[model samples]
Target: MNLKFYTFAKNIVKIVLSPAFRVKTIGKENFPKDGGVLICANHIENLDPPIVGITCPRDIHFMAKEEIFHLPVLKDILPRVNAFPVKRGMSDREALRTGLSLLKEGKVLGLFPEGTRSKSGELGEGLAGAGFFALRTEAKIVPCAIIGPYKLFRPLKVIYGNPIDFTEYRAKKISADEATKIIMDEIRALLSAGK
Candidate 1:
């Protein structure tokens, strides 16, 4: 990843966003100091990824939709900032492999378990991809909630909950769906608290 570019982009984003929103972050202390971690967040808007990315203390490699990667300028910039494409509405095995590889290498992987943005601004049902990665690597899962009306000068909050451990589930070999539910439940709780 382009560390210098990532830092520069993050700073620019912070400056651009600071004037329009009262961005607040909570539970940053919950992030793991080392090792791979899966960050599962509820998707609400297009800016969600960068919002979480900047607020997060660790550098997050996010799995963005493949379509976005096709955009003109973003196509070139996204990859440099640790963003990768994942085909949606199908079983994109290559994306899965990339995510798993990052985790196994002790890198942070950010995913929107809902798969797509929530049009109603509410948390949606989570997909199994996140759970599968968590189970396979037994990586700590951090449930995040991004709450916003996104109005001018309005308050926008990103809350990170305590990390979830799947050691027991991995031992019992739980289904991916079940594991996803657990992760989603934590996200729901965070959203509830954020409001």
Candidate 2:
């Protein structure tokens, strides 16, 4: 599908499907209208990325697993939305390059810091990759969380927290692990507020 049409369709999906899900966002004003940003969210369900992406007014590029790119239908649409493949449990250098390049181009990149969806709906530990990218690119980290149920048409809530200034940490030359913990804590704070 064409990018415009796909985004249009995505908007429709958000309108029709999201109401049933009770999707809501807080601290949305913190998002920069046009610039590089890194949205680091918690992964609870497979539905997380699209749900968050749809609600946002801006186009966001999400890092998807390489296998999804192989699907014929996804091959056409996913890439247009700025999605690229990241080989799980591997270096995935190309994926990192693509993500950073997108940031350099002043686009938003969405990532689940946990790296994968948690079946139990509990918060998972964040990986160092997200921290590394944020540090390297000096991108603003917008901590977010997707809460509520995930069954078909079930009520869901997406909470966006205030964007944290990673620039200081980046400038300090903080380690990726340290950055990851800081980012994860912010995400946890958002989730806690929702409760």
- The top-ranked prediction according to TM-score is 1
Clash-forming residue pairs, model 1 = none
Q: Show the lowest summed lDDT stretch of 10 residues, model 2.
A: 150-159
- Which candidate number has the best lDDT? 1
Location of the lowest summed lDDT over 10 successive residues in candidate 1: 14-23
Off by over 4 Å in 2: 152-154
The residue-by-residue lDDT of candidate 1 on 43-141, one tens digit each, is 998888889988999999999999988899999999999999999999999999999999999999999999999999988899999889989995789
TM-score of 2: 0.92
Q: What is the C-alpha RMSD of each candidate to the true structure, in Å?
A: 1.0, 1.7
Residue 49 lDDT in model 1?
89
What TM-score would each prediction reach against the true structure? 0.97, 0.92
lDDT of 2 by residue, 1-195 (tens): 557875876887788767767777666777878788899998987777788888776788899988888999988878776688899998888988998998888889999988888888888899998888889885778888888787656667777777788867977999988999999999888888887
